[model samples]
Target: MTTTSTPAPPRIALHRDRLLPAEPATRGIARELYAAVRDLPIVSPHGHVPAQWLADDVPFPDPTALLITPDHYLTRLLHARGVPLADLGVGVADPTSAQSRAAFRLLCRHWPVFRGTPVKLWLEQVLVEVLGVDLVPSDDTADDLYDAIAERVADRGFRPRALYDRFGIDVLATTDDPCDDLAHHAALRDDPGWHGRVVPTFRPDRYLEAGLPGWADRVDALGEAAGVDTGSLAGWVDAMERRRAHFAEHGAVSADHGHRDAVMAPLDAAEGERLYARARAGHATPAEAETLRRGLLFEMARMSADDGLVMTLHPGVSRDHHAPSRERLGTDIGADIPVAAEFTEALRPVLHAFGTHPRFRLVVFTIDETTFSRELAPLAGFYPSLYVGAPWWFLDAPDAMDRYRAAVTETAGFAKTSGFVDDTRAYLSIPARHDASRRADAAYLARLVADHRLTLDEAHETARDLVTTIPREAFRL
Candidate 1:
């Protein structure tokens, strides 16, 4: 007797105008607009893509680690639905083929949780568009799908550098610590076989927050890296400046900050030093630590004003909301949460000092959507130094992005907004996420054209700038 196997679900598909307008006339214009910029080389000005990955040019260890675990959006949602991080291969450095296959199956069994989300969209692209997998993930077909992706990932065409070339990335910037040696960046820049651009953006949040754990060690490391003493606040400042110079020399153009609030208060030189001294001695209270943090914000603006590194500030994220999970998994493991942020008053001090400075440039990002029209847009409208960053991270979904365009364009206009930034640690999601933003922008611009607010030619040119020139100019790339 011959037995026939039951076939799996249909192969996945993406609509050519997946995010275009609902109206027929508007969809027509959006289709034209999307076509113009769909193939433009990606310009990623700010992200967490590890420079080491590109420099090493290595094959991905496994499909599960590469596609499922590193993505907080995927892991966090699954965690919310009663999945343990360890079961998904969260802490394992080099998972075995069996363990990796198990995690992939876990993800497949819970696939319904990802329905109608940006994470789903990005994963679909990675599976179908990038890997050419035919199976839609589900419990019935998990093992087969895993084998299919695992086989593709092991091929030479799937190596990091080869994929980078295929992704059409022109400029890819990575977020990094001020104390980092950036040796990987130097390696990529100097490699003859590699032509991809991977630059670093200085991130000094933990080092500035004195009350945070490991501040003392990080401060010492910064001093050692810069060849400056850290016994005094002035020495610390000098060390920071030296590191910033080093970063710029190796092709960095910007610095990034993720403050709990947007406050940038002025401080006297002696007073600032006194607070820092107390912090080093482990005597500063939380209030003192916060004050010192705000004061450093002012100094950071002062330095950027002098050295010309564009400042990208995203404030009001309540990180490590789940204390136990954070303790177990460490930072950026999907435990962070968003909170309301204030701007006008908190930023007045720095804005007044550097708002008109020729060398200073600032791009502000918020997870607080209420402030988009009420605060950020108006501030960007008035200050020459200010621009609104892309709606990303928590707000990278379709509706929030469309709302972002509507909220800011009236006050700041397209010219004063930072172009789309795919801020991900996931290398494979780079083009997929950027494609989402492009489609969203096309739909929004098509509406403007339909409403007679913009001409088709004007919309076409704006689409080009949003993907290419805006990010380049905003980050000074």
Candidate 2:
């Protein structure tokens, strides 16, 4: 007779209590504080969740599609660890026809790769809190976790609107292109049964770039969307104005721009008109393209002042860093790479023109961490119209968040910052990311309280600000 081996028991609890303060007195205080604010509603003022998900109210297809396909954060990290993109069902490959189960099993096998990383923490939280799954997912339990998740996702309760309500999200903002018609947004607004507040953010990257190969066609689309002829400089400007008005009618309170650099060049009307003609004719030289883009950015600032839409600029990303990948998959598919950015000098033209103006509000973001104190904080400290955006992209993790506060708070202070924006395409990870941010912030504040630098009362208030007040006020939620 042969004896069978016994499997180890899976960890069932979140372990948050131990992961947080452990000293008896400190633990009691943290538990009490966390209890009071643990259930506060989430305010997501900036993100990339598709509105159609809510409008259509359809169940997500499968484990791979639901969790793996749309999350670039997960895919990029896995790729960094020598995992091929095709194995994760990423790139332009057909995930639906491929062996999704095998791919998901591979991810589950490599779950340990996420240990000590933010992704692991967030996934654990989502699993334990959101799905109520206690068993740790590994190769041993991969099939069980996948089947459970897929089953729950097939239910109507897991649809976008239901999850939005269940998650207690107070406000959600969805980013949209300049040429978008926003029909789904209108549908949501008109639906009496849906009470969730989902708003649109105007992102005009395609329209702003004059050097793109298809700029003329994109301009024509913008004109058609706005019902204005964009053949002339004046007409193109009018088209942009019309589109902004349309976006405002859809409850848009912010306009976002993702550019290669934050440099702003203010051109006189004649110069602007000349550059516009070149761009319209598809004959613009590199210098002319730069001049036109800068001119348009200045005009966008003026429009924001007039329309009361907060302007957010994300710069220094060298888009399509992998040329072959871009040729195969187009933009925003994990090809964007960060570069060193200059804020003080690059933004001088726009700042000098409108930085002190009360009507204008500009929030700037950088992937370069070195500039946080040296450039961003100082600029935000002085410019009334400028505020430093939260640590973005690769810097959204826990340690980076801590470094951001440690570096910027001394100079820019809390008031000069715009709080946090999740900026995610993964809808399920929202709460997890925010939870990590809150914990990291609380830990930082606890240190301040411990060192006598701040009172506990002040730390509590600051925690609330970082979570709720700042995003609401900064994004006009």
Against the true structure, what is each candidate's TM-score?
A: 0.98, 0.94
What TM-score number comes out for model 2?
0.94
lDDT of 2: 0.82
* Alpha carbon RMSD to native, model 1: 1.4
Compare the candidates by TM-score and give the number of the best one: 1
Where does candidate 1 stray beyond 4 Å? Answer: 1-7
**Candidate models: Cα lDDT each:** 0.91, 0.82
For candidate 2, write residues 1-477 as lDDT tens digits.
999999874875777663355566666555555555567888888899999999989888787877776777787777777777667777645666346777778777888888777778877887778776777777988888888888888888888888999888888899999899999999999998999989999999888799988998999999999899988777888988888899999999899998888887778888888889988888899989988998888889888877888899999999978887667665676768999888898889888878887778898888999999999999989998888898877898878988999989999888778877888888888888777777767766766676678888887887788778887777777
What TM-score does model 1 achieve against the real structure? 0.98
**Cα misplacement distance, residue 1 of candidate 2 (Å):** 4.8
